[model samples]
Target: MATSTFRVNVLLKEGVLDVQGKAIESSLPELGVSSISNVRVGKLIEFSFDHEGSSLTDEEQTKLTKVCHELFSNPVIESYTLTEVK
Candidate 1:
């Protein structure tokens, strides 16, 4: 069996208030950083799975999607993207 690596990016949806992002943005000027706007904080999760064959199968795709929805992110306020790492 080979191991496949995946990266999951989880972030708050548009129109949702990102309080932590706001706080960091507010403090940037004081930290001598300027001209940065629209700051948003998010999570990056990298994981690997053991499987057969060269690439992920349809079932693996579905399972990863389900995991993203059920575990890594909140379906109501957050969105996630999954990508295979080569």
Candidate 2:
């Protein structure tokens, strides 16, 4: 069996309200930095799976992506990207 690492990048949808990001944006001017316009926050997740890369097919990858979409991400407010890495 081979083990592969995967990286997941998650971000808020455009026009979504981010309270934390909003707070950061509001505070930037107090710190004497006035060039910033907007801010958004996001999450990054990484994990590994053990499987036979030689045999695991594209269908399996699709299945995994669907599982991620269903279980790991909120479709209403966020989007995610999954990538296989060595």
Candidate 3:
């Protein structure tokens, strides 16, 4: 079996209100950083898979994406992208 690495990046949708980002944005000026306009917070998830080949097949990749969407991310508020690194 070969090994594969997957990287998942999840971020809030555009126009979605991020309270944490807003707070950080508000505090930037107080910290003497006035050039900052806006801020957004997101998450990065990395994991590896053991497969027979160097990478997963297209069907396998699609199944993995479905699993990610159903289990790892909120479809309404968050969007995610998956990449194979190795």
| Winning model by lDDT | 1
Model 1 spans > 4 angstroms off: none
- Give the alpha-carbon lDDT of every model: 0.91, 0.82, 0.84
RMSD, every candidate, angstroms = 0.9, 2.0, 1.6
Global fold similarity of model 1 (TM-score):
0.93
Top candidate when judged by TM-score against the true structure: 1
TM-score (C-alpha) between model 2 and the true structure: 0.79
Lowest summed lDDT window (length 10), candidate 2: 48-57
- Could you tell me how far off, in angstroms, the CA of residue 46 lies in candidate 3 after the best superposition? 1.0
Clashing pairs in 2: none
lDDT by residue for model 2 (31-78), tens = 999888768878878887777666567877877788678877888999
Per residue, candidate 1 scores C-alpha lDDT tens digits across 11-84 of 99999999999999999999899989999999999999887788878997788889999999998999998988
Error of 2 at 8 (Å): 1.0
Clashes of 2: 0
Worst 10 residues of 1 by lDDT: 49-58
Estimate, for each residue in 1-86, the C-alpha lDDT of model 3 and write its tens digit.
87778888988999899888999998998899988876888888898776666657887777788878997789899999988774
Ranked by lDDT, the better of candidates 2 and 3 is 3
- The residue-level lDDT of candidate 2 at 52 comes to 63
How many clashing residue pairs are found in candidate 1?
A: 0
